[model samples]
Target chain A: MNIDAFAFDFQELNKEIKSSGQEELNIDNCMGQRYIGCGLSRGSLRIRGVPGNALGAYLNGADITVHGNAQDSVGDTMNEGKISIHGSCGDTPGYAMRGGKIFIRGNAGYRAGIHMKSYRDKCPVMVIGGSAGSFLGEYQAGGRIIVLGLGSDQPCPVGYFCGTGMHGGKIFLRCGQLPASLPDQVNAKLADDVDLQEIEEDIRQFCAEFDLDRETILDHPFHVLTPNTKNPYRQLYVHC
Target chain B: MQIDYFYPEYEVVRNKEKCTRCGLCVSQCSNHVHSYSEEHRRMITDDAKCVNCHRCVCVCPVGALKITGSNHQFKHNANWSRRTIMEIYSQAETGGVLLSSMGNPKDMPVYWDKILINASQVTNPSIDPLREPMETKVFLGSKPASIERDENGRIRNNLPPHIALDVPILFSAMSYGSISLNAHASLVHAAVDLGTCYNSGEGGLHDDFYRYSANTIIQVASGRFGVHKEYLEAGAAIEIKMGQGAKPGIGGHLPGNKIVGEISKTRMIPEGSDAISPAPHHDIYSIEDLRQLVYSLKEATGYKKPIIVKVAAVHNIASIASGIARSGADIIALDGFRGGTGAAPTRIRDNVGIPIELALASVDERLRQEGIRGNVSLIAGGSIRNSADVVKALALGADAVYIATGALVALGCHLCRGCHSGTCNWGIATQDPALVSRLDPEEGRRRLVNLVSAWTHEIKEMMGGMGINSIEALTGNRLMLRGVGLNAKELEVLGIMHAGE
Candidate 1:
């Protein structure tokens, strides 16, 4: 089913999509409509034009593809879904996401993948093809965040304070050197073959999704970042 | 190599004449304050190890043990009290933030004690609660501004989703990670029995507790732990924890060591990973951003459940509450500075937010003046100690009251304020297997039920005394309350008159 969402507000468009009982939907001319597939468990939605903040928040198991740029909080706290953005996205693209995958073909704004955690058998993944803004993966408890930086010349792809307060998870950055502003709480090392194997399938998937050559994307030396200490606050307090 | 400047604050006294060498005290204390001395043929006590939990004293087979404050005191200096001197010494030694558990124990004014309730005389007939049908049931949510009728002239069913409470008392938020599963079960069972609700604070709900979802209010905080589609849909209501009163403006850091096994699974994080809840929601930069979250949750739930926004009772709370009300929240829960916590920095817990009484009064007045009081129901919490405090909160404009410390007290908490150590002898705040097993869920549930039931009965009696047949009638009825020994400025902020006037 194709929906011309030019004249419809977010609530009306969402209501029509939910109540239509269709398994597949194509939302055209979508102009900054927030929460496009909010909490939708099933079905596939293809959105054209710009979508607003929190596009697929709490999405259970649906598939959402945004043709144009998406706003902040693209997949806020989303679980069990796949969101693909063709263009650049705003801040906090995958904030606190527990599961599912978010593939951004273009650069992402600040705080992408912040607090993204993983439970048993459910690991969330986010792949940023271009540079990411500051505080990337801040306080990230689990999951994988890969920044390819497909066409950048900087020392690192992520901005300052990357992985600050990070306690879990690994951030794979395709860079020659780690960010200078990286906090002491996180440790960075050159990616080994064993370390690269963990994210090989995810990188291959990202390459296929964005129609890029896998060999070219994997040509550069990568730096994998992991939290040095799981208990960052163990020594910060004394019992009164 | 270290000189201990601070002495033990408490002394453990054991009576030799009455004592039998049963070794009950040795096993009862989790702090290892008592041990058998084989050489001396008696039990030895470590006063420094004692947290004053009273577990050993209560469980001793013979009446032989008592704990008392040590007579050791600092020099006669008014400013440098004993606690102050010891605290400085301790900080100098460890160089760590002083962390405390439970509510503030500072000498602060509790307005509930200074407020007096009204009774009817010959002017108005006081009804007997036992003989009359006193209505205590309250529906919490937004009420319609005007009545609507269908085409057939019948009243339209335009009421939105709301929660019904048999009494105006609710068990406040205490997460599974910060407390034992048995403690959570007790609150859940008691809430179901009382037709009220218990909140699942920040921590994700355990699978075993899903059966009591009808009486649960699941919370979503900064960390968004264990918060997923299923968890969001499993509760009667959703609460967005903006701030905790005990440590307002600061986020909670449940150390990684405590996040093990069930807690790790429940919170959906790796075992031994720090569960850090950031102070502010990165997505919520303004009221507009808050609205987005509220509506997003609403859309996710299909608008079936109410959304509660819980914030600490801080300065400018009235304005903050107004913003929340306009943000499409169905309820606003205000937790005051004196609210309980599993652990908080001693400085922050002692001197952070305002008292619940004053916060409630100002917020209620602000909402009413703006004609938006019906937009959201107010739940006042902090130090609601007794039935009288509940009554006083209602009179000051709280739709209901949330009780946490009081409920834990009912479940055998000795108020030792040692929850941060993760060695609660009462089993209310620890995740240790043995300590958790100490609290039987059935007994805890019964005690909670008894406490709420007794409080409900007393609330009805107070309403009857005020010539009010229903609790709703007593809400925001400041005439039912009078200030006693409160200064003029204090009464003005409380929005109450003097006792004589």
Candidate 2:
């Protein structure tokens, strides 16, 4: 449906869009109204202004694009969908997501992708163009998290203890140097051709959306982090 | 030679005449006070073994057992008395951690006891419970915002989903793992019979008890264990357990050892792995976040179920209740400090949170002031002891009362405060196969039903005496209650008047 700039409750507008028999929905003056295109299975939501927290929470199979920065907890606990943010997003961009793709063009706040999990044939992916905050992917159970440091001078775009309590999943960082004080549970190493192959599709999709060269992004040294299986910590207490 | 130390309170006495050769108590005692001698003709009783629960005394079939208070000389001073000495000794033994159960066992004034119930005297006539139709039935759910009518002026879907209780009492959340399967079955069956609801605690619903969904309030805590499509659909309502009163600000930990076969399966955790429910739902950072979860569950359940947010009665409970009322929750369950637990850090259980009476009154008053009392129904629980406490809770503005410890007491809980050990002699709190088998569901359920029915009769009697015929009339009727020894702050928080003038 073709629409013009109007101050509408994003929730109501999104509801209208889902119920309407239209392929494209253009929401204008959408100032901080939440759950836009949330749980929508088949549709395209195009927004002009800033969206609120949980922009596409539990999104099943729709596609959402935000013209401006999105709030915290974007695509939170979602099962499937694709969210492309033209501007930077806030913290916990893909929290507890089981399946989906979240592509952000700017920096993410603390603990992004925290508790993100995955299952067989459904590994969620998150790509950030700028730096991420401390404790990134804290307690991440599963899923792939990639941070591409494009125009930043920081040695590492991610912060200290990047993958604390990370039991499963892989984290790819497009930086030469790894953080010094990584947790003992996680093993960090230079990404080889095999590591690059896993996140190749996600990087290509991110490059295609934001007009970045995938080969140049892959040329930089990458660090892949996975949980160390040998040094497993167990039995922290006595029963009696 | 080392002398085995007893509590200095109990004296173990045995009858020499009816002494049996069987030394079952000797092997049963965990204190190691009993020993068998091949040469001895009869079993010997050592005085240093008992914690005064009288388990051995009650077990002996031939009536050969007796226990009494030892005549250990403490200078007769009321201030420095036996209880004081015991407290000190307990602290010394457990290194200053005082663990207790079944409400505050200390000398602190019990407000429920001090508060007196008023009845109609000469001016207003009293109705006898036997003759009059005194309404003890309570329905817990969201009442309609306003009645709606059809074209013919007939009622059209005016009623909200509610649990109709024969009395304003319910079995509170004591999980299957914390107690036993038989105990859970007993509670479920009793709740069905008694026309009340039984909470499924944080433990997931047992497969066998799926038929009792109408009487079950399934819980979802931080762990979200066994919480899926079926678990949500298999309940009358969903309770989001935010904080437990017994151990406020602390999460639940069903130790790996207790997680056996079915318990492990229901909790959806590996056997021998501690089911650690973190103190908070990581996603629930604010009231708005709580609303998301509440609505999500409602959506998942097709909005057929009312959502209950159970929170611990902390110091600032009134303010918190205000926020919860606006969080789209249909019911607010307030658990006080005196509530029971399978296991909690001793410090948190006894030393934290406020009394339920004050919390209930404050929350009701706060919601009323905010003009949102109609938004949510309040169910108060912590240590609702008897019919008197139930009536008092209603008068204090609770729509209903949740009873866990009281129900367990009916089903053979001794309140030994040793639930952490999981060797519950009464078979009410243990997960051991043998101990759990001891409690037959048939008999246990009957006991619970009897307890609730008896309490219902007492509640009706109390209501009839006050000339209040209905539970709805009794709710927030503070005039029916008067404080005897409560201070100004207590009386203010309780929203009741002092005894005289």
Candidate 3:
């Protein structure tokens, strides 16, 4: 089923997409249409042109492939699904994600992978191909965030205040130089062999999805950040 | 052991002449406030442990027990009060943030009491509610700005998904860990029976209560605890909990002791780990960011259910509501400062957030002025005690009101203000199995149903008295309301005129 996105309300488009019998939707000319494939499960979506904010939000088990750029809040609070963006995505990608994979072929904006969590077998994985903006993975409780500086011009791959309030989970930045002001609550060091193995399959899939050299991306030194203590707010409050 | 330094705030008097000594209070009190001393052959009261919940007073075989404010006052000074001094002592004793339960009980101005309702006297005849068909049923959702019709000249319903209710009342969010499983069951059953809805707070939906999904509204707070695809699908709607009235700008903290077997499974955390909901949704830093989240939930639910953005009533609420209305939210639920909480820092609960009455009025006026009132339904709450408050809230512009403290009160909550302690003598706010069993859900369900139904009847009658047969006719009809003791600013802010003017 193909829906031409022209002069149609986002709500109307969504309603039609949901009520339609077709499991595969090809939305063309999606000029900044917001909330495409939201909360949808058991579907395959191919979106052309720029999709607006909250693309595939709360998306449950839907596989969305955006051929062009996406605006802010891509995959916000998405539970289980796969969002593959071939172009650069805007801010807050894969935020509060519980289980899913968000593969951005290009750079991501600020606060990507913030508050993403994981349960028993469900670990949400976000792979940003290029450099990410500031406050990356802020207050992340669970899940995995991988920022591979495959192609970026900045002196550092990530901007200021990366993983500021991160408590649980791990943030892997494949960069040589690190930010000067990482919060003292977290530990940032060279990725161990165990950490590399854990993200090996995700890196492989991200590379295959974007047609990148997997070995080259992985050959770079990676830095993994995890909360130093279980109590992140130990020094935050004065007890009284 | 901690030294005993302060006197109790309440004194329990038991009339020995009428005492049968049935030992009900001794067993029923979860705080162990009463015990039958063998040496005295009489029940001795422990005032220090008592929260004045009135469990003993309610359960006493005879009318033999009464609790009153203690006369153990310190030397009075105009600048220093007893409570302030004691609070300082307690904080000094245990260098921890003082936690309290329930709403603010300070002597703040209650705007609800200042407003008055007008009844038809002459020109408009009052309708008989009992004899006539009175429509109290309300549907909460975004209404289309203009009606759309099919090409065949047929009316097309283009409105979004709505939460339909027999009356304009909803049970506000109270987490399972904060309250009890039996309490949740009671609320769920009562909501189902009354054709209303109750919230699951920040706690994940308990597996057993999944059967009552139709009457449930699963809330997504900052914690995202127990938030999964199944949990999102299990409710009629999803509420984005940005803030609560009791503790605005603060995250929720479910103490480790409250995280038991079922709670652990529900929240998807360990058995004894503290569950904390962060202060803000890191994704939503701005109101436009709020729009992103609102759409996210809508997308997640497949646009099948309404998405409510619940916020604490703040100083600049009207503008906040205007932004939320534009954010594609189906409903905006406002909670005032007096709203109940499972637990909150005492200082924050009392001092933070604004009154619901003012927030409701200003937000409604702003939305209507912006011609966006139809875009979102409004629900106001905090301390709506009766049907009149419901009527005033509607007349002031709320589509409906969320009731929590009032609902809990109907279930035998005596406002003991010890909910954070988690040893609720009435079994209304505790997770203890023994204490929880005291509150039979069957009986609780009946009581809640009765309370809501009776309030519905009162609201209908109030509407009829105002010469309005349908609730829609009374909604945002400021002519049906008038200010009594309110000043110019108060009246102007409320958009209502003084009586006889």
Candidate 4:
């Protein structure tokens, strides 16, 4: 199915896309058409131009490949499936996403993977090839976030206040030095051989998807951050 | 163990002749004022532990208890009375916390009471609610961008996804940890029986109430406790709790002491860990960020459920509601300052936000001005007291109203303003298993259903008297309301006219 989104409103275009009965969708001239392919399952969407916020949001078992940069809140609160972004993405990339894998080939804005959680068998994964802005993985309860600085030259690829209130989950950053003022609630250390082995598959996949050398990426020192305790705020508010 | 102290204000006295020595008061008192002595074989009172709630006086079988002011009297003056002097002295002793409950008990102007409803006299004939088919059923959701027709000129997709209600009233959000399981069960049962909805209040959905998912609105606050796939998919709608009216700018903190067993399991946290919902959703910094969350929930729910944005009524609410309207939300729930909470700082609860009435008026006007009134349905809450307030709220342009205190009142909450203590005498807001079991879901649900049904009938009657057979016509029809004693500013804020010319 081939549709020009500039001609119709998002609702009309979405209705045509849903009713077209085609497994493959090629949306051309897509400009700020929000909620495109939203909750779409069992289809392959290849977006041509820049898609709006929440593209492929709550995408359940579908494959979405965006040709260009994506807007804010991409794959927000998503449950499953894969969204491969060819260019850079916006803020809160995977906000509260419980499951599925979001791979960005370029830089991501602030609060990437904020409030991302994991359940019994569902662990949401977000991998950014470039640096992330401030407040990375803020309030991250569970899941895995990997930031592999491929082309960036800065000594520290990630921004300030990384893992500020993080109580769960593990963040792997391939950087020379960790942030100077990491919050007291988080523990940061050099990724050991076992830690590198755990994320080797994800890193290999990211390298394979974006066409990067895996050895060059793995050669740099990586820092791993995890929450200090299971219950970080147990003694803060009330007299228990 | 006798300790001498100065009695500043009041004392509790017991009439020995009327006292039956049943020892019920001894166990009921939380402050340990009354006790049973084995040697004396009778009950004894320790006067220092009394706060003068009059509970013993009211509960005494023979009216044996009375409270009196101790040696604290004012000189005979025309301007001041003894009670006034005692009140000041009591405040001085207690260091001026000024705890209260229900609504504002101060002598300020209650605009809802001052505003009068108008009925049809001659031009338009009034209809009887009992006889005529008056429409009380309301659906809260986005109206639609535009009701367009196909090439055949037939109606196409007239309804947006909405939660249909038999009555306009719904049970507001009171989490399981804040209240008890029995109280939550009673509310769920009442919502089912009355064909309305009850909010899960960010505590996460209890496993036992999965059968009542259609009548539930699962909440996602900053804490995101117990928010799993099943919880998200169970509810008819998802509400993002941005701010609560009782304590705006403050997050919810169900203390570690209260998080026990099922409450802890449901929230998916440790047994004694504080379930802290941050003041703001750390992710959302702007309206665009808010849109991301709204759509995320929509995506997670497969776009089958409508999303509701619940925000406290604050200053600049009109503009804030405009942003919410454009945030892809189907419903906007505005809570006023007088809303109830289990626990809040005393200062924030009393003097923080504006009234729901004024907020509703301004939001309605702003949405209509933006020509996006049909895009999002408005549900006003915080302090919707009775059927009359419901009618006036509809006239002020609310699609529906949410009620918490009123429903609790039906379940025997005495409005004693003691929810913070976590030992609700009525068994409505406690975690203790023994206390929770006192409120039977069956009877409590029946009482709530009765209260809402009675209010619905009254709403229908009021609409019928106005010659408005449908709730849609009654909405935003400010001509049907007139202010009786409100000043010009109050009238202007409420968007209604002063009484007669």
Candidate 5:
């Protein structure tokens, strides 16, 4: 099913898409059509223009791709399937996603993977080719977030408070120096062979998806930020 | 050696003569407070470890055990109370924020006790529930101000989905992880049998319980745990939990130990990792943002389920509820300060938020003043004890009342307020295998059914005595209620005339 979403209402477009009985949907000129592919259990969506906030929210097992930039909350609480963005996305992208992978070619806004949790094999992965804003992976219980500094030469690839309240999961940032003065709960160290090996396949997949040299991306020093302890708060608050 | 800062609040007492030295208490005490002594061939108990859960006492074969308040005394002052002194000492010792469980146990003025219900007299004779047609049925959702007909003058059924309740009572939000799966199953079965609903708190709904989806109210809090397509679509209604009454401005942290097994799989978080729901939805900083979330859920569910916006009863509760009425929500749930929690900072639990009675009266009044009272149904929670409370809440302008602590009690919770430890012996609040197994869902469901059924009967009797046949007629009927000892301000806030008027 092909939809020209230039002047069509978002609700109407979604209604038509759901009733069209097609697994593959192509939407053109999709400017700020919010909640695209929302709660879609099946089907693959291809959007030509920028989608709005909460794109693919609670997407159970669908695949979505945007030729242009996407808005905030790209895949909020989405369970399964994949979302690939061609350009930059706004804040809280992939927030609290439990399953599937989100690949972005350009930068992402604040709270890229806040509260992202992973369980068993249903791990969620978010890879950003460019820089990211602050509060990256904040309160991240699980899942993997890899930010590759493919663009500008910033000292640190991400902004401040990176991986704050991170209990589980690993964050890979391509940078020379660590972000300054991390919280007492987290530790930032240069990636060793073992750390690099863990995310090697994901990094390769990211590079392969965005057309980048794997060897060149691997040669640069990468910094890993991890929580000092997963559950540091055990009966910390004791009332008399 | 670690220094003991405070003494045991209660000491377990055992009758040596009655104790048979069978070691049953040793096996029953999950806190490991009891140990069998080889030297004396008797049970040695630790007073400090006793949470007074009564697990041992309840399981004792010889009916010889009881917990007594310790006689330990301190050089106390009126202003500097014992608890205050210990609190200061504990803070000085560890510098930690105080954590506690359950609802506030402080002796604040209980407004429900202050307000009196009036019975019909000779002028209007009371109707007997046994003989007369009494109704406890309540439909919860937004009702149009008035019915509008179509072009042909035929009545149109354009109302949104509403929860049909045989009683005004519902089992409130106690998340799957916070309580055991068996407990959830019990609530599910009970709600189904009682023609009411139970909430899936913030924890995501387990796949096994989807059969009871019609009786569930899946919650979408700041954490959005276990939330997905099927979860949102499963429930009869969806509740957006903005704030809890116990800890108004606080988030939640389900510790790593409890986040194992099915809980981890259900919540989709790693095993043995802290699940922290932030204090506020970062995206929702204003009312417009709140409206967007409400509509987002509505769109997600295809508008098949009613959206309930739950907010804590605070100082500005009237204005907050007023704004919520216009937020496209079908129902507004007001949780007072006495609401329960698995774990909360003690200060907030004891000090934050107002009582539900005041909040409900004011919110109902405010929505009515704004002429949007029909836009949403009002539900009040926060320590609704019995049938009388439910009736009073309805008369005070609430369409229904939610009960959590009562439901837990029906499932064998002693309200030890140690739910945060995840070692509930009666099995209502714990995820531990043994403790959870102790609570048979079949038996738990029976007790729960009995509790709500009894409440329903009592509610009918109360309504019958008021000469009101149906709950819809009794709703917001403040004339049937009178203030007992309340002053001018309290009477005005409650919108009830003083008794003898």
Candidate 6:
């Protein structure tokens, strides 16, 4: 079923999509409609044009592909599913998301993948083709975030304050050098064969989705960032 | 070393004549305060190790054990008191922020005690609750202005969702990581039995408690821990936790040690990883951002559940609440500075935020002045001590009240203020398996039910005395309340008249 989404607001468009009784939907002319495919399961959506903030919030088990640029919080707290953005997206692309995969072909704004987590057999993954903004993976508890830095000229693909307050999970950046402003609580090292091998499939998947060569994306020296497990804030409080 | 060493605050006084030396206190105290010496043939008590939780006192078979405040005093000075000096010494020694549990134990005024309720005289007849129908039930949600009608002259049902409560009390948010799972079980069971609701704090709901979804209010905080699509759909309502009362501006940090076992699974984070809730939701910078979250939740839940926005009672709370009331929220839950927490910084808990009484009064007045009071229901919390406090809150404009410290008291908490230590003598706070096993969920549930039931009876009695048959009638009825010792400015802020006026 194809939805014009031209005459309807977010509420009406969502209502029509929910009651459309179709397994697959193609939303066209979607200009800044927020919360598209929110909390939806058991359906596939293809959206054209720009969607507003919280594009696929709390989305459970639905496949959403945005043909154009998306706004902030693209997959806020989404549980299970896959979201693919063909163009650049705004901040917090996968904020607090668990058990899903979000693929962005172009650059992402600040705080991308902040607080992304995972559970047993439900690891969340985000693959950004281009560079990412500052505070990437801030306070991330679980999951994997990969920044390919496909066309960036900077030595590092991520901005300042990368992995600030990160307690769990790993971030793979295809870069020559690590960010200088990395916090002491975070440990960054050059990725070895084992580390590169683990996320190779994810990089390949991102390359395949964006019609790029996997070998070219993996040619650069990669760096992995993980939180120091010594419990950074342990001695910060005393009983009163 | 002598300058740094301080005397214990409490001393255990054991009666030598009545003591049977059963060693019950030695086995009962989790803080290792009591130890029996084989050579001495008696139990030795360590006052410094004691938190004064009353566990040893209650468990002793003989009526021989009692704890008393030690007379060890510094040169009494108005400016530098013993507690004040001790806190300074503690911080100087450890160079760490002082952390405290439960509510503020400060010397601030509690306005609930100053406000008095009115009774009926010969002009108005007091209805007996037993003989007459006195309704304590309340429905919390946005109230529609007028009924819609169809073209055929029939009433159209366009009312929004509401949470029906048998009483005007709810079990406030206490996350699984903060409290034991059994504590959550007890609160949820009591809520189900009482026909009310329990809030699942920032920590996600456990899988076992999904059966109680009919009485659950799942919360979404800055961290979004354990929040998923199923969790949202499982709740009777959803609450967006903007801020907590104890530490108004600061965020919550459940130490890495407490994030173990079910907490790790429920929160969906790795074991031994810190569960940090940032102070602000990154996506929400303004009321428009709040509206986005509120609608996102509504869109996720299909607009079937009422969305509650819980905020701390801080300065500029009236305007903040006005903004929230217009942010498409169905309920506004205001938690005052005196509200309890599993753990919070001592300075932040004691000094931050304002009293719920004044905040509620001003927010209620502001909303009513703007003619948007019906847009959202108000639930006030922070130290609702007794039934009188509940009645006073309603008269001050709260649709209902939330009880956490009072509820934990019913669950056998002795207010030791040691929750941050993760060794609660009672099973209410700690996650230790042995300590957690001490509290039986059934027993806790019964005590909570008894507390709410007793409060409900007293509320009916108070409502009957006021000649108000329902809680709705008493809500915002400030004429029924009079200030006693409050000054003119305090009385004006409370929107109540002085006594005899």
Q: What is the Cα-based lDDT of residue B194 in candidate 5?
A: 92
B326-397 per-residue lDDT for model 3 (tens digits): 998999999999999987888899999999999999999999999999999999999999999999999999
Per-model root-mean-square deviation over C-alphas: 1.4, 5.5, 3.3, 5.3, 2.3, 1.3
- Could you list the iRMS of every candidate? 1.0, 6.3, 3.8, 6.6, 1.7, 1.3
Q: What residue pairs are clashing in model 1?
A: none
Computed on C-alphas against the true complex, the DockQ of each candidate is 0.80, 0.13, 0.30, 0.18, 0.60, 0.73
- The best candidate by DockQ is 1
Clashing pairs in 2: none
| The 10-residue segment with the lowest total lDDT in model 5 chain B | B1-10
> Model 4 reaches what TM-score against the true structure?
0.82
What is the descending DockQ order?
A: 1, 6, 5, 3, 4, 2
Candidate with the larger TM-score of 3 and 6: 6
lDDT of 1 by residue, B50-160 (tens): 999999889887889999999887778988888777778788889999999999999999999999999999988898999999999988888877899999999998887
lDDT of each: 0.92, 0.79, 0.87, 0.82, 0.88, 0.92
Quote each prediction's TM-score.
Answer: 0.98, 0.79, 0.90, 0.82, 0.95, 0.98
User: Model 5 over residues B46-153: C-alpha lDDT tens digits?
Assistant: 999999888888899888889998988687667887777778778878889988899999989889998888888887779898998888888999887678899999
Which regions of candidate 3 deviate over 4 angstroms?
Answer: A1-30, A46-49, A152-156, A175-178, A211-221, A229-240, B1-4, B14-24, B34-45, B62-65, B93-95, B268-274
TM-score of 1: 0.98
Better of 1 and 3 by TM-score: 1
User: What lDDT does candidate 5 reach at residue A35?
Assistant: 79
Residue range B433-456, candidate 6, lDDT tens digits? 999999999999999999999999
Candidate 1 to native Cα RMSD, angstroms: 1.4
| Chain A (alone) TM-scores for all candidate structures | 0.98, 0.94, 0.96, 0.95, 0.96, 0.98
Q: After superposition, how far is residue B478 of candidate 3 from its true place, in Å?
A: 2.3
Question: What's the chain B TM-score of candidate 6?
Answer: 0.99
- Indicate the fraction of true inter-chain contacts that candidate 1 also forms: 0.77
lDDT of 5 at B365: 91
Clash statistics: count for each candidate: 0, 0, 4, 0, 2, 0
Model 3 lDDT at residue B2 = 49
